[model samples]
Target chain A: MNRTFGEKVFNVFNLLFFLVFSIILLIPILYILQQSVDVGAVKSGLSLWPSDPSTAYYKMVLGDQGIYGPLLNSIYITVVGTTLSVLINAAAAYPMSRRDYKPNKFLVYYIVIIPMLFSGGQIPTFLVLKELGLLNTLAVCFLPVLASGWNIVLIRNYYRSIPESLIEAAKIDGAGEFYIFGRIILPLSKPVIAAISLFTGVGLWNTFTPALMYNSDPTKYTFAVKLREMIVVQEDMSRQFEAMMQQMALSSASGQAMTNEGLSAAMMIISIIPIIIVYPFLQKHFASGLMVGSVKG
Target chain B: MERKLIGKKKGGRLGTTNIVLTLMVLPAVILLTIFHYLPLPGVAIAFAKYNIGGFQEWVGFENFQYIFKLNNFWRAFLNNWMYVALNYVFIFPSSIILAILFNEVRIRPYKKFVQTISTLPHFLSWAVVGGIWMLLLSPSNGYINQIIEALGGEPIYFFANNTTFPLLYTVIAIWKSVGYNSIIYLAALSGIGLELYEAAAIDGAGRWKQTLHITLPGLKPTILVMFVLSFASILNLFEPLYVLSNAMVRESSMVLDTYIFQSGIMQGRYDISTAMGLFKSTISLVLVLASNFLSKRLTEDGQSIL
Candidate 1:
């Protein structure tokens, strides 16, 4: 079809809007990267471009006695948590997807509605975790959120799309439920699994509230909690510095050594790197098919 | 006779196997039962005069009475409603628009680039976003204000001003979430049948008219589901406000989640906080059910949620 002049104008305007929006979106990320590299630039004042850039902050963040411990903690939780969650959710979803499974509808409703409608508030959940001796433990970070209703729903929806004839044929081969699930279902279910894994992985990696609520130990802090501490502590430190500067003008020392902006930017850049690495790999699953498949079912 | 005995044994084995299947799901079931279901009864603590390190003294409905009497709770409730309304009115629609615009771009590389840049903010913790926002919105030396001065306008201290804080919070929330939320809508848009658009075009419908009649309607189910879900969890907004809020905007910024967080965690007033939480949850539950009912009545397919 031939495009009209008005259509052409609209398309051009849309392109311009997208371009400007994209630039606006990227500025913060770029600013962070610049701050992370240019210590002197930040110390002097904020600069759009670093005159002399270095990897000193990167070295510090990655080295021992740095925030690397918490980074590793986040990674461990995300990996183990995503794997276990996907497995459990997939297993439960498989039987439920089968038409012949007894009490299927009720089970689906029970799993779906309970988490959505009702949740125990944080205090009692905390008390329960404490009673279970999960407090101050790394397991606490992943365990409570392991069986998500949304994930179960998503997996079940995906499983429903698989042809029933495939399962029926496997059953006719005298295969047990486990064999059909292992040999037939898991292989056919890779795309949905990948999608759910990415969703759960990002969720676990970025989760801070549970970490704060459950684990008070600094050593057990995930990357997210440490990032919060860094940002909040930096704000606190800057306020202190301001107060100190006000008092010090009446006293001897004229020079201040640290700036909060650089530290905060450094910490932000550090916290974001893991997500950046994982995000591109998972980006494909978030494209149209994943949701369409489930929604159609 | 031997074959019959073996078949009987196998039948018994299958019965035990089903029990094992049930057992396999036990860990999740047990954790959920304890952590999720157990705390429900504690919602009653909202009614009683809850005391820490003390015995079972039940002063019925006293906590609820106190909550109703408190001016701060009312203010917080109003503030929460404003925040939620702003989110729904602006941020939600903006996300759908962004998704449609994103879908219209045919250039593969440019689309990916835009998608990546836009979604980057969603990955940052609210603390980091707050920190960046603080720098950007700083009364002095803020990049945004600096640009405003360069353009010969007065610099605005957004976070410090109560009137602008809600708008600021809403914009930042949209900036962070629009990309992530749009992915779902984009997924919906992609599933739309191309033949419908072709059919519309053949009927002399323009792009705008086609979108009005076809694209928007095609996206209605997803839009409705998302809106209902967003409404259900409106009171759960905590991270952004908690991170961005300061003394300047404190009066306007206190929402249900932040209030609960402060009372329960910071002040160690567990009972009042739990009461407030129960109140919020009850409202959310009602909203979810009402929205689901509404959706079921309006749509032929019924609601996908619940």
Candidate 2:
């Protein structure tokens, strides 16, 4: 393709524009990273370069059981919740996806879609969970979020693309519904399943509202809740640092020299590390899954 | 035996009458009923005096009347619309412009790298994003303020100031979502026919003219659908607002969702809070319906997102 002078100039502008925009976008996380590693006492600027880079903040964060408890809870909920969410939504969606299913329209519209549009609000939902005696339990973390209307919709959308003849053939061969679902439908729907799992996983990993509302026990808190408590709420970090110092048998002078900002930045990085790790590998699936789920909607 | 016979008679279209299929759907239905449908009637708590003992006094709209009288409620209500208006003016078209720019990129690797970095924030929870931004904007030792001090200007307290808080809110909101949101438009852009651009080019159209006449026109339906769908979230400003709000910025940042949370959970005024939730839900429903109606008018086939 032949490019005109104006087009060449525009291309140069666009490339430079994106270069600057990308840097601006990245500066926050990079700054946080720098802060986490910087050992300087009187740091007050945004420099991508760390001064006296040290792993002390990470070590302190890692050593603190306060961080570990929430970390473990977040991981547990994400793994278990994503699995159950995928299974429940997939199972429910399978029936709705069948072209011959009589109640598909009614169920999709009334039972699932209506609720998506008009929610019962937070207080009512909280009250319902309370009535069920689910508050403060690990079940509260995963159970309510297991079957979202959106996930079911996405799964059903993908399932609908599978040919009916495939299921009919399996049925004619004396294969049961469960066998066909397990063998044929599920194996063929890996893309959608992976997509929903990633979506659910990210959602569960980052969930704070559930922990905040349903669990009063500090031990039951997820990483998100703990993070909020530490950073956003500015819950006494000086005491937390003091506790760390005592645990380490470090002198009070060392504790006085260190600020909790570094520790907070370290925790923030730890919280998102899983996401950053899995993000590149799963990036393609996220976009494709969104597109697949968006079809005919 | 009977089930097999029935399946054979209907040529294997068992519908949901199949026991296995019904069983598969049972857990979801049960859970949805407990979590979603059950709380629906509980919205009535907005009208009644709620108690821990499961006793309710029929206050009959007293709660709604009470919240209506509160200055805070009105402020929060106005604040919700303010965010929505700002979103329209800035946040809405940002992704579209971003997608257009992304579409113009000739190099695959640079585009991919930029996209990866830009979309990273969307995966982060509001807690983490908010924490990072707060640190970056902190009045003391924050980078932005540090830069100001270096430049011989006063270090501004971005979050504490009502004026600067909204500006901060808008920038963060855009930064967080622009790349992720642009994916939809980029997908739409890919679907546009290359033949149209080629034909326009043959007809003495420059690259700019081709984009204007062919590319944008092709993306019209998608842009319209997205615009209409955005209305569904007009009042949904809880997460970002909750994470970023400080006491100093409360008057500017108080939104309906957080107001409900503060009043109901923290203050133990569940009744009035439920009333506020009810009001929010009602308006949200209206907005969704209104948007769907608008979508029907906007789309070429008169298709509604609902």
Candidate 3:
């Protein structure tokens, strides 16, 4: 199709705007990457690119005393938590999605509206968790948010879009409710399920607030809390630079080399790596699922 | 035959098994009820003088009166409004425009690249994103200030200056969300029958004309739904502000959610925070209901979000 001069100009302008915007989104990440790789550059000053790249910082983060346990703890919680959440959410959503279910619509609406309108506040939630004997436990991280209102709605909406005739055909073949749900509904709802799994997994993987509130036990700390401690400690060290420098004249101190910029960058990269690996596979469904669930009534 | 029919009717009676459906939903129901619904009664604490022991005495309307009297609350309220308004004004439109532009991209690899880069920020937690932004907006060696200086402008401390808070907040919000938000528009755009665009092209319509006449109109329902959803989240603005804000810009940066987090959780003033939360929720609920009502009135096909 032929385009007008004005149209061509507008397209050019659009391209330019997007190019600039995309760079704005990526540059910060690149800067962080540069900092994380260069211990020498961080010590000297900030630089756009690393002058002397080394894997030493990454080695320190990975093999550092007191870091590996929290890392393992985070991985364990995220994997177990995400799997349990997906199962419960799917199980609950599948039943609600059944055409003949009498309370489906009401239940769906109830779940959706509750999160939007009300909340008991943090203290009450903390109190409830405390009373349940789940505080500081890994189960506390997963169970409270098992069946998210948003995920349920998303899965239900996806189930609604499935052809009713397909379910009817399965039912006529003497399939029981559980059999039909497991064999037919679950298989057909893969995209939505995959989408929700990614969403829930990312949320659980990055969860910090619950860990902060519930798990006071240093042993129970997730990667997020551990990362926070690392960042905070490094920040404190940065603030005490003059004092540390003065102390350096008196005596060479061990563990005084920890800098805010390097450790924070390393932690940031570590926190993001798992999600980054998982994200691309589910990228297509991520936006579409969210839009469908969020924008649709 | 009559006996068989009678037997079937007796057997088909709604049994105890039906209540299992409610039982299945009970966990979420109970959790939300305890955590979400239970907070409603505590709104009463807002009216009472709250102490470590809980509401010590009935101080009817005193908390509300005090909140209204406080300059901090007013400043925070205005700041919250400004933040939401800026988001609606800029990010909302930008997403729509980006979706349209993205749709126009016919090259397969370029489309994938754009989509991949755009959605990266959504995965990064607010804390991490805030750190990145902190560096980016740093006065000495930050990329943004460097660019400003290179362009013959003064280096601006974007974060420290209260005046730039709204703009910075809006830009970061858009950067984080625009890609994610545009996917709906992209989906809506794709759902539009190609015949309309083809027919428009046949009628000598240019790209801009075809977009105006075909694409925008096709997106009307999606746009309406997005607008309603965005309005619903107006009070839900907390994470970015919480992470990025510092004391210097606190007056302009403090939002309703952050305010509640500080006053309610940090200070242990449950009554006041509950009141603030309840107030925010009430307004959001009303707005949602009103919008849904209006949507139903205006469009026959639109589902009522309420």
Candidate 4:
């Protein structure tokens, strides 16, 4: 374990490389953070430090009750979607995990995997959704992921990891399958469940597509959908802001200068905050879960 | 495999366990059937003159012929392939290199910190990342542009530059995914036997030699598996283009998804859109089967779930 001079030099260079790489990765985020807090700061362009930092943007964006409604919608979809997907996946996975469940061999290989490989494209799915009367509902946001074939396969793989003897022991005691699953399997399967839930939750929270495709009602917009509009339709947002200001009988020109750039930057940071908050909890399960899924299924 | 009668032993031949399990599975099965399986038939709409309530006549191969006749279909197809090609050229190798560099870091805290920070962005939606990047590169206000101006260069729109856009787009994609994507490599790294390194070191093999001899060889199967799997996802390049794309770089950035959205989805030309969708889906299916075959061939324990 003695290091040569060259090895020592390489070590220094390695550390320096990581340091620079880390900072480069962080620069955009730190810049966004700076832009969010500083009033009219984004208009001036990027700076290492803000000349005048304030929570004006946050206050301005949060002031509209309309904003909180979308946040609520995002939460509703994320929570409902994650919970239902996990349940559906677990329910489907349990039978398949039981090696003797003969029907599932078909389900796992063909029904689940094949559809995942290729499907009727979005037009068909869109038509189907409309046919089912799911268009313009929050159900549109969550339905697609709720029983996704990928999740079913993933959960089935996780379920297979459970010891058969535990179920066998319960069966010998004359416990029904429901009791065994409810009491034993579900409890033992928390880690995988948590992992998939995190995946689903984050995905649902961040999705704007379902809203864009299925819903035209402004009230149905998720925070992500709203953020996308806010990000791209900069001029429209300012015009809306002006209209809102007039509607509120406030002085439009002199009250505060809310550039679309500043507003969108604030919206972006605000939208991402939830994911960042839950990420610590996500880190533990997701890493191991990812490796497990890749390694097996 | 062992049981003579699955439910016969305790719950009867067509036992309560079978019945109950079937019941438990029913809701999910029906959901998947409705959502995934139902629309599968609607893929037929690609061949038909699909009017919602209007007379629907099957046009046979007319739609396919139309797609073939269109230049945009080919353009979008080529554009998607370009992303895939660029991805393999730069993103794939760099991820491996990143994983190797990360594996070499002897310092635990700094290593963990960097990995955490790098992986953090992967959790952000493409829209959010696009927004952040848009802010970071705005001509008047972008951090990068500010630096560009500091160097006495005129402000240049990074997203608009078709020539440099692919390279920059790949970099952003890598930034979002590189750390998260390195998990398999990291896992593969940990799976390497320590004795191999010891054996190499005692044979006068330094860090570089050991990596070349032991580390890379150990990572071969995983790298191949990852390569094969990612190939199937080449057509699923909707999010980034949807989020980061603009008219400024439409020539460079437009791909199958965006093209479909513009010409098919927006225009309500469901027939052509469905045709395009079927075309893309067919390729995806082929790629999936191809990757599965490759995975099974490449690795000892490989099982192609898809």
**Number of the top candidate by DockQ?**
4
Candidate 4 C-alpha lDDT tens digits along A1-297: 799999999999999999999888888888888778766423444456765677888888999787887889999998888888878878878887776665777777554766657677788888888889998899898887677666766777777788877888888898988999899998988877777787778888987877887887888999988888777887345548767877999853533455566777888889888888888877876556352332111
Q: What is the C-alpha lDDT of each candidate?
A: 0.75, 0.82, 0.72, 0.79
Model 1 lDDT tens row, B56-91: 567677777888898889989999889878977898
Q: For all the predictions, what are the DockQ values?
A: 0.36, 0.50, 0.34, 0.51
lDDT: which is higher, 1 or 3?
1
Worst lDDT run of 10 residues, candidate 2 chain A, spans: A288-297
Question: Which tens-of-lDDT digit does each residue in B1-306 have in candidate 2?
Answer: 553455556545555346778789888888888888889888888889985555468899898888889999999999888898899899989998898989999799998899898877888998898999988887656788898898999978788898778778999999998988888888888899888888887888997788888878888888777866676666777778998888889999999999988887767677888899989989888887887888788777888777
Rank the candidate models, highest DockQ first: 4, 2, 1, 3
True contacts kept of each: 0.38, 0.65, 0.28, 0.62
Q: What value of lDDT does candidate 3 attain over all alpha carbons?
A: 0.72
CAPRI class assigned to model 1: acceptable
> What is the DockQ of the complex in model 3?
0.34
Off by over 4 Å in 3: A42-48, A121-140, A163-174, A213-221, A232-259, A287-297, B1-26, B146-156, B297-303
Residue B94, model 3, lDDT? 88
lDDT of 3 by residue, A1-297 (tens): 687788788878777777787877787888888767865523334346776677767887877778878888888888898787777777777657754555667776677765765555555555456657877887777777776787777777788888877766775686655676779888998887787777777777777667766788888888877776666565456548647667777543443344467667887888889978988766877555442443211
Model 2, backbone clash pairs (residues 3+ apart or across chains), number = 0
Candidate 2 C-alpha lDDT tens digits along A48-91 = 78767888999998998788888889999999988888889899
Candidate with better TM-score, 2 vs 3: 2
- State in Å the error of residue A202, model 4: 1.0
Highest lDDT against the true fold, candidate: 2
Best by the TM-score measure: 2
lDDT of 4 by residue, B1-306 (tens): 435354456455356677888877777788878888889887887888865453379899899999899887888899888998888898888878998988989888888788888777878888788888987887645778888887999988787788888777898998888777777788899899999999889999999999999999999887887777676677877778878887778877888787776765567778878888888888887877887797787677766534
Q: Give per-residue CA lDDT, model 3, range B1-306, as digits (tens).
A: 543343243333343323444455666676666555654565666667774466588887877777888787777778777876787789889889989998887767767787889877877777677777776676655667777877888978788888888898888888887887788789889899989988988889888888898999888788877777767777766667866787788888887778877776567776666667666767777877787788777676757755
